[model samples]
Target chain A: MRPLRRLVLAIPALWLFAFFLAPFALVAKISVSRPLVAQPPYEPVFSLADGWQGLWDKLSRLTLDAYALVFSDDLYLDAYLSSLRLAAIATLLTLLIGFPLAHAMTRAPRQWRTALVLLAIAPFWTSFLIRIYAWIMILKDEGLLNHALLSLGLIHAPLSIFATEAAVLIGIVYSYLPFMVLPLYTALEKQDPALLEAAADLGATPLRAFWRITCPLAWPGIFAGLLLVFIPAVGEFVIPDLLGGSDTLMIGRSLWNEFFENRDWPAASAVAIVLLAILIVPLVLHERQQVKERAA
Target chain B: MKRGLQPFHLAVLALGFGFLYVPIALLVLYSFNASRLVTVWGGFSTHWYEALLGNEALLASAFVSLRVALVSSVLATILGTMAAFALVRFGRFSGRTLFAGALYAPLVMPEVIIGLSLLLLFVGLGIDRGFWTIVAGHTTLGLCFVTVVVQARLATFDRSLEEAAMDLGATPLATFRAVTLPLIAPAMLAGCLLAFTLSLDDFVIASFTSGPGSTTLPMRIYAQVRLGVTPEVNAISTLLIGFVGFILLGAAAINRLRKPQGSG
Candidate 1:
């Protein structure tokens, strides 16, 4: 019975290994390959090709040119910084909005809690691209936002809102806010109310009790939600591509352009490899924490 | 003391909900506008929605997306449910932890990385990147979700019933089909629904895998979105949101019905 059980695990395990891990290993390998003159970017070295000259060519040819290209390029550097800045700000905004909203959902009448969660998650099921596009109609020059502001005499002219950094930030936060809310809500919901009462009884102010007791208790969920939003937001291509102008370059779009436009797979893979390296620490930590939670 | 609702909190709640819906609602409202300019309200008219009906390309993409979702979600549910059953019902093994980690790798791995890597894999293997490749990709991602949900359901399952069935001379497969299948049907259905939703909404992976002219609806919308917004896309957005809203309500109704009759 145990043997049969082990066999069942084997198939799925091997599937992930072959498809998931192997492909990533391939990316890392391709990132190190030599670039050719005219014939595409990559040229594999054959061991049986010939003499000392061939051996020297293969041995000396493992170049960091691709990685060097990514680093030296102004757009790539700017985009990387912008992606981080935008993602950081957006994750913070989501947390600010999500915390209170999630808290409200948890504290709401029990009958309404499920309804609120459904409401929050319903937008997620709708087409994500469409939702981002919807923001364009609202944020553009003659869009709904301008129309509203103008009609209310709040502004003299239509605001230049669309395709700006603000527009991208709003779109990203709007799109991923539900992801932030659900996990935080899960964490906040599990907090024992008695702990808060205990804090208050011990002469802590309500705000102090919340900061020390509630926040610490819910840190796991906060961290989960933060990582969840941050990681995706960093690699976010669509929202930034659509909503951001030349001023707001992002790493995802740079990677996209490298592959689709430049036809430089090695360079694209290099960018991706660096991204993977940067993300590996946070991702590993997140998974470890999740596993610990599951065990508990 | 009468605990009145805080006006500030009420205002915040109202604004938050407004932030969530106003853009989407504006999009829906403009879908009926007569003007080509998405922002301008040239009076109430359903011209774009009417135009959308005649757009063969949009319809074809929708069809492709539907087929992918249906096939992949079904495949994921079956494979995932079986794997979950094996993991829970069967005793622990040497590589159980490793197996569990491998199963979940797809779930949290960044979609951009997954898509690029998979595309690279297809290229390396000399496999054509198209609809079948997309279906394979979707199924792999969907399976992780299904496995997680089904494993949760199986965690609290009563094992004695299965033991008794075995003692009564029922074959393992027969016992599984007759007893276990009936017990975890809700979870199985939930897993399927979840898979369907994920596969339907997936854009990044599909964008990477889908060949030219095989654009999914999201992909089409994305292509349009880069240039500018259009009422046609807005109409599609409205339709999708409406469909999702209906599903959510139905799921809630089913959940309510499943609760005990005398709980009140």
Candidate 2:
């Protein structure tokens, strides 16, 4: 039994350690290095030039230039801020739209619950890029939405929605709506029906019962949904790049440009490390909360 | 309790479904457009599908993406099942906290960070970026999700059945292979499907790790979208959607047939 357990644990442990932990440490190490014109395009902060003392000298070779550059430049700052802002707004919007849909699912006939739940997840079965691309076709100036508006005589000019922050918001909300909805539905679905019935028997209005009973009970779902959407949205690249104009600067794009376009691997690592830094507190809190939940 | 959906709930659900489906519907409708322009529908035609058949680069990328998705998803599922088994069945082991943290961290870690970190690791190790790198990135990304899913199934499994088997003087390995494997096979299949879909849909990690002449389908589609949408894109997208929809529905049908009535 012991040998079997060891074998079961060893393969995955080694794999994740090598591919996951080591890479993350590499990010931290490389973020402190200077940009160079080489194959990997970054100077190694460590070297073995003259044995022990050479290693000490190699440590000194690492610089704070990348972190300093991020702080000094407004581009990186704005990218961080806008990513948070867009992600926050998108989270709120998805919650608003997703709440009703999830509520509707819980209220759906029990016989249809599986189908309804499947409906919520169906979009995900398609290629994510195509789903985002579909929005581009619908929101572009000469796209379907504008065409409908024009035919209805509601607008004389095409709406400039395709390459704007609003477009990015639309794409984010669209892509993540299921993430927001599924958890909320699960939370809502699991509520004891008798509790809501008891609330009703006490003469609470339906809306009041929802707020007083459903919302309070579903708080965990809301938090989970928010985390699901916000964390990924903040670092989302494909949606903003496809839907957003130059005005929409986000950390994901910043990291990509520094690595690929600007060829500054260290700078890109800095952006990612900082992005992770900003998110770590919330992430840690969430994890701690999960641990507590599991304990209870 | 109400016996049926309220009018208000129906309206909201209708609107939500419309929002979800309309864009996809439009894409399907335009796939057959005779006109090259996205908005202008000249007439119905299959020209774009024919063009898609002729696009060798796109075909090659799709093939690579398929092969990558297949290999990585299988590897991820195996690794993920092991992780799930260790976490659930084994008592606390050395480095449990670190192992658990490593498992959960990737769940919310941004693709940019994961991609960058892994790419740098590959470069640091002098491993050239290409097909193997994309598989490595995707396997890392999908491992957590598969574990989460398979762990859910493991949590609900009837453990005493395995216990009974073991009590009959069967070795743990024999018990697992003979009893547990068949029972959890459905969940494993589901987990594999999820890992496959995740690998297929990935763009950021794939883009970061992919090298010259190794473009995946998403990479190809993203490059083409930047140039502007053609009917060809819509045709290919519709086909992809159809293929995925078939898989999802088929999976659902299987689950429906197999599921016990009173439980989730």
Q: Interface RMSD for every prediction, one decimal?
A: 2.6, 1.6
TM-score per model over all chains: 0.90, 0.96
TM-score of only chain B in every candidate structure: 0.85, 0.92
* Interface Cα RMSD of candidate 2: 1.6
The true-versus-predicted C-alpha distance at residue A1 of model 2, in Å, is: 7.5
Best by DockQ: 2
lDDT of 2 by residue, A1-296 (tens): 57778999999999999899999889989899989998768876454456888787767889999999999999899999999999999999999999999999888888999999888888876778999999999999999889999999999999999989999999999999998999899888889888889999999987899899999999888998898888889999888999999888989988998888999988999998899999987677666655444333
Q: List native contact recovery per candidate, as a fraction of 1.
A: 0.46, 0.75
RMSD of each: 3.3, 2.3
> Model 1: residues >4 Å from true position, as ranges?
A1-3, A35-41, A45-62, B1-12, B86-92, B95-98, B167-169, B246-264
lDDT (Cα, tens digit) per residue for candidate 1, span B26-62: 7788788888887567998878888889999989998
Against the unseen true structure, what C-alpha lDDT does each candidate score? Answer: 0.79, 0.88
Compute the lDDT for candidate 1. Answer: 0.79
Which ranges in model 2 have alpha carbons more than 4 Å from their true place?
A45-50, A289-296, B1-3, B252-264
DockQ, each predicted model: 0.49, 0.70
Candidate 2, position B56, lDDT? 97
